[model samples]
Target: MAVAETQGIEPVDLAAGSEIDEYILDDGVFKGGMSTLRTATNSVDKKVMIKFFVQETSYQRELSSLYSLQKAESRNVISLIDYFEAEEEDEWFPQSVIVLELGTVSLQHWAHGKRPVSEVYLKSILLDILGGLESMYTAGLVHCDLKPGNIMQFTCPGREQGIWKLIDFDCACKYSAI
Candidate 1:
């Protein structure tokens, strides 16, 4: 579908527009981490998943990740398409927002990693993810949070299948020399 086409999904209304968007349905994502639903009304008619830096400990690194990925290639890494800060703040958390491609329902959703995703498919996902990481590493960045919640799956309407997208750069620190 054209990027200009608005996917029919509704935008996650941030009552206060902050780091934690209560407007997004809690059920939108598979995990407990903060989330925001991104509906494209003008392009790409579909639901875009957004993960937030709900925790304060790793927030700074997110900025670094965003900057590092800015220089990386498109397909290998989860590109940082755009970013915005919500002037509206929650009673408690700081106002912050980062846009990224939505990952899959959660690889471990089946049984806490017990029910493994297809080996062949999983390998393909990891390839893309690692390539991105390797590129980041070359650029002198360290993505500390390499857990399940941080990896999202990217699927397009025209594409026959989806690919794994490494996300949540909130914990990605610049440990290497630029």
Candidate 2:
């Protein structure tokens, strides 16, 4: 990842040992964004990944989309395990509580800018993304942002390797309720 001069000091640190918010995440080559604190747990162990926000202006819309996605695409989308409003330790703290998820790594991390992702990996990712999009589509939702960082890789309870999972729905579609 290429990181440049930080205009503002990062308020949080998002690594394995502790949680943080308002930190600079310069990991993605496609985008530089904010890294927030999050926690994840599988059947065996719990881990954390610095959650990045590619779009901060629409955090509310994205968060709402996530709730809807979670209910319908639970099987395919990376789960947002927890979220809550943040309390100001100081008077200047940000108001929104951060969204958390179960998986942190993505397909790009696997491919490392290499295109023509292997047929097997490509097929697996497509299927999982389709499953997630189908659920959203059925709900009249659209995933406006379908890029590398948003698509994470994870091994669910019964799935094998290459079981790609979708995450980061800040640009997800909106559907009328039934």
Candidate 3:
């Protein structure tokens, strides 16, 4: 992987025990209101995605929300492998790195292509989305930013390709008590 200066700081190189390594920053593939997405390889040569939060507060909010979802252990939600705060001398605030499983593609990309998916696949994706939403609802969290980009496709064993999963909890929030 090539090294480049991002936001005036070098990409972080994670050490052992971090569950991931060779943390080289790649081109930003997806951009969201709270974070930028890049692809990376983990220790075992598995391809993963890293979400680099632009601000510390945004990082904290996302971490907290993910932690809640983690406790739920919902399969429909994105699986967070690990996260850490990168310590850098040149940076004012440490960068929070959230490692997630790399999806085959985002739903947005598929939809934008204007190709029609099989009805069975479409139903599967829809059910998966609702399942994820129900899990969030059970945890008392609301996924405020539900969109095609936030919904990803992955290949599941014993099933055809394009199994969809809901991702991105940066803007997710707890429901207000009534």
What tens-digit string does per-residue lDDT give for candidate 3 at 24-116? Answer: 544445666677677777666777888878777777777888788878878888888888786676353356778888888788988886667
Better of 1 and 2 by lDDT: 2
| Model 2: lDDT of residue 9 | 26
Off by over 4 Å in 1: 1-46, 51-60, 86-94, 110-119, 156-159
TM-score on alpha carbons, each prediction: 0.61, 0.64, 0.80
Q: How many backbone clashes does candidate 2 have?
A: 2
lDDT by residue for model 2 over 1-178, one digit each (tens)? Answer: 1122212224343223222333223232222343353343333344433343534545666678777776785577766654544334543334354445446467778778677667986777788878877877765787887887777877566666646677766666675667
Residue-level lDDT of model 1, residues 36-151, one tens digit each, is 44432113433344544454444446756667676766365576645555333432334355655555554445227455568976677678678867777776777776876566
Off by over 4 Å in 3: 1-7, 10-22, 25-28, 86-93
lDDT of each: 0.53, 0.56, 0.73
Better of 2 and 3 by lDDT: 3
Query: What would you estimate as the lDDT of candidate 2?
Result: 0.56
lDDT (C-alpha) at residue 62 in model 1:
72
Better of 2 and 3 by TM-score: 3
Superposed on all Cα atoms, the candidates' RMSDs to the truth, in angstroms, are: 7.8, 6.9, 4.6
Total backbone collisions for each predicted model: 11, 2, 0
Candidate 2 regions exceeding 4 Å error are 1-9, 13-45, 50-57, 88-92, 113-121, 175-178
Pairwise TM-score winner, candidates 1 and 3: 3
Which candidate number has the best TM-score? Answer: 3
lDDT of 1: 0.53
